[model samples]
Target: MEKTYLTTDELAKKIKYDCRTIRERLKDSVLIEGVHYFRPFGGRKILYIWEVIEQDMRVSGHGFGIPMANGEVCHG
Candidate 1:
C-alpha cells in the first residue's frame, strides 16, 4: 500500500504547528525517526508518515503526562 508522506512544511500545515517547532522540539522527542519519519536515500530531507502520525496522535495519552525514553510516563 502506498502511504501518505508529508514534508515538514506540509506536516506543519496539517498539524497546525510551526515547522521549526516540529524540527526542534517534536522531532526526536515525540516524532521518532523511523516510526514517524524517514530521510529518503539517507539524505537530510525528512518525510513524515501522515497515517502513522495521525494514528498515534489520536491515542497518544491517557490524561497522564510526557512519555519518556526510559519507558516511563511522567504525570504533571
Candidate 2:
C-alpha cells in the first residue's frame, strides 16, 4: 500500500497543530523518526508518515495522566 507523506506545514494543517509546536514539542517525543517521519535521500527535508501518525493519535495514552505539550505525561 502507498503511504501518505506530509511536510511540516501540511502536517500542521492536517493535525491542527502549529508547525513550531510539532517541531519543538512533538517531533522527537511523540512522532518518532523512521516510524513517524524521515529525511528523504539523507537530506534535511523531513516527511511525516500520515497513516502511522493518525493511527498512533487515535490509540495513544491509556493510563491516567495529563498529556503535556512536550509529549510527556504530567502526573500532577
Candidate 3:
C-alpha cells in the first residue's frame, strides 16, 4: 500500500489547527512520536499519518467510553 505522508503544515490544515500549535502542543503531547508521526531517514523532517490522526480525532471525546492506555473511546 502507498503511504500518505503529510508535513506539519499540511496536517495542520487538515486538522484545522495552526502549524505552530501542531509542533509545540500536539507533536509530542497528544499526537505522539511513532504512532501519529515519524522522522524519515533519521532526518528532522516529520511526517504525519492522516488516517490515524483522523481516526483518533473521531474517537477522542471530552468525557466518555472505554479508557485505553492512550486515550478514551467515545460511547455515543
Q: Output the number of the lDDT-best candidate.
A: 2
Candidate 1 vs candidate 2, lDDT winner: 2
Candidate 3: clashing pairs of residues: none
Better of 1 and 3 by lDDT: 1
The Cα local distance difference test for each model comes to 0.81, 0.82, 0.74
The TM-score values for the models, in the order shown, are 0.78, 0.81, 0.75
What are the per-residue Cα lDDT tens digits for candidate 3 across 1-39?
Answer: 556889998987876778886776567767888998999
Itemize residue pairs with steric clashes in candidate 1: none
**lDDT tens digits, residue span 1-76, model 2:** 7899999999989977788978877778778999999999999999999988887867764322344855785656
**Candidate 2: residue 27 lDDT (0-100):** 77
Residues forming the 10-long window of minimal summed lDDT in candidate 2: 61-70
Question: What TM-score does structure 2 among the candidates reach?
Answer: 0.81
Candidate 1 C-alpha lDDT tens digits along 27-65: 887789999999999999999999888888778553324
Q: What order do you get sorting by TM-score, best first? A: 2, 1, 3
